[model samples]
Target: MIISHKNILVSGKHQKSIVTDVFYTNEIVQKPVVIFCHGYKGFKDWGAWDLVANAFAKAGFFFVKFNFSYNGGTVEQPIDFSDLDAFGHNNYIKELDDVESVLDWITTTHTEYTDFIDTTKITLIGHSRGGGIVLIKAAEDARVQKLITWASVSDYKNRFPKGADFEKWENSGVYYVKNGRTKQEMPHYFQFYTSFIENKERLTISRAAKKIKIPHLIIHGSEDPTVSIEEAQKLHAWNRNSHMLIVKEADHVFGTKHPWSQQYLPNALQKIITESVSFAIF
Candidate 1:
């Protein structure tokens, strides 16, 4: 049977705790670890991600998913937009640091996982914004053995506002992006924009993709509305060694929606999970 643990807190940036969940079998053999990073306005427990974690666990991987320290989710409640203030203060750099903290907890003194996981064989999977962060991290961190991105954004600069909107955000110090599902106004502080500018070179997905020597997989939908399919092609163009898979007629989330009560993984998600498991193990 597979063992799963949730709400496990690890220390991360800004003196905040990173809430996480780990899924793995209690088998004696060492299993490769898969660390998943969620996208913007996302938490660890959103949608059918628990099922995604289970799918990875069943596929012989010690799957892990965590909220960024500033992801607005607390240890008591690791879902939804609970703390918008923490969410607003968040930046890509902090997200990178948070992922590293999870890595550190898994590979080192975290005794609960050390015996069952092969920390050296860590693979990272990110969706949308998180995917871009993974590319940047995998390029710099030697511990990451493989990488996969689902409908990932190609660049950080393009996501931010431009012209007057940009000027207003800079002057006001924050901008609110309405959450379609929650109907809450989510804040993206100007520091978010400033962070991108400060670390422009390091945060560039194309630059990082070209530098990645290990295996990489790009999974995206042909009709993704949130992020175009061209982003995937651009990533592939930079990293010629990487493989790209486009799901026909798939949208951004591949039909997986929040509040998903289904017992099984969606067809699109299942395909990528199977493919990701294969890619990570190979």
Candidate 2:
């Protein structure tokens, strides 16, 4: 039977709490650890993630996923954007620190769950913006044994605004982007760009990819409109030893969307789960 633990709080960047979830069997058998990081504007319970966790747990792996401390979700509400102020203040560095905190909790602090987690065989999986975070973390942390990214961005600097738009943001201090689903205007403070500039070297995904010595798997959807397939190719090009998989006709979310009502994983997402589980085991 799959044992699911939800909404466990962990200390995160700037003392903010990170909402976490863990899934595994009740067997207490040592299993390889898989930590998942959600992307920008993402939460732990987004879409079909709960189903994803159950899938991993059933496959004989201890799966963990968490929300970034400042992803705009509060402890009471771990889904959707509840606090835009916190979201505006969020930066890549904070997200990285949050991942580290989760790592520490799973490996050393969470004694109750540690019995089922193989500390030395931990793998980090990230989606979209999170893909970059896990890549950089895997490069810096020795605990991570394998790395996987889904629809990840190759370059962060390019994603930022340029010229007039950037100047406008700098002058205004913050910019707003409409959340198509929620119809909410999300704010991105100029500090976000400044923080990236300050930590440019450490946040470089290309450099991290080159530094990772463990097995790295890059997965992307060919039809992904949010992040192009070439980004995954770039990651592959940087790490020649890395393997890449392109899901033909799959979109950014792998045929899944917010408020995913289906009980089972989508066909494209199931393919990813199979590939990822195989990668972690072998």
Candidate 3:
């Protein structure tokens, strides 16, 4: 398999947006394509994603995993939290738009892979929060033939605290949450909540998952603390055609972390990647 990293200027929320993509392909002539979207605080090179991309490419698919425009990375520096302002200002609607932009660019603008890509067969894969984004995108975009989520959330509203304080948040200009690891205060402007509330009907994960007439797969870890296995069950329940698989003892990242090393993947993560490829093909 040949794996290469490149950058593309995608139409973003602002004037000019840059996205870094990890492209994977074997020497095969033309192959089905899978485009991956990372979750919050996730970039294209996060942990073992590159390895996963390679695995998919080796299995005879053209895989591309990209960093969201507002994912805190830049064209100059495609890794880490160098652009917190873009990260803080990001919202679900913008992400959905970004993914659409990427798809449009690949299918219409990118010429080198035009003959090598089977545009008719396109799949969108997302992890964690990104899973919700893909679900919504798939429901709305008929171009997406298959949808898959890794440790996906069934509902975006559940991420926030409920009740009358919702109005309190509306009045406040911004809300802050602590990153347990980085210890940096993450500021979610009131506009985030407002945008979500305004677009709730369009952004509902369950609604999107349920409406998906195409094949869907939900993969999660039984011991995942970040997103419970039940979330996977909920996604399956919402989409009767969807298949759910739970790894017995994998964590949120499937046993991978930042600055990860060692070539071999954890047993559970390998299973997740393998099963995802099988589902995509089947």
Best by lDDT: 2
1-282, model 1: which lDDT tens digit per residue?
Answer: 999998988888679999989999878778999999999888888889999999899889999999988988777778887899989999999999998888888888678677788988999999999999999999999999999999999998887899999899999999999999999998999999888899999988888999999999999998899999999999999999999999988889887999999998888888888888889994
Checking candidate 2 for backbone clashes, the offending pairs are none
Candidate 3 per-residue C-alpha lDDT over 174-276 given as tens digits, one digit per residue, 9 for 90 to 100: 6666766666677677777778889999988878878999999888988899988888988998888888888888888888887668787778889988898
RMSD of each: 0.9, 0.8, 1.9
On TM-score, the candidate that comes out on top is 2
lDDT of residue 279 for candidate 1: 92
Looking at candidate 1, the ten consecutive residues that score lowest on lDDT are 107-116
lDDT, candidate 2, 1-282, per-residue tens: 999999999987587899999999999789999999999889989999999999999999999999999999999999999999999999999999999999999888988876798888999999999999999999999989999999998989999888999999999999999999999999999999999999999998899988989999999998999999989999999999999999999999999999999898899999999999999994
Clashing pairs for model 3 are none
TM-score of each: 0.98, 0.99, 0.93
Off by over 4 Å in 1: none
lDDT of each: 0.90, 0.93, 0.82
How does model 1 fare in lDDT? Answer: 0.90
lDDT order of candidates, top first: 2, 1, 3
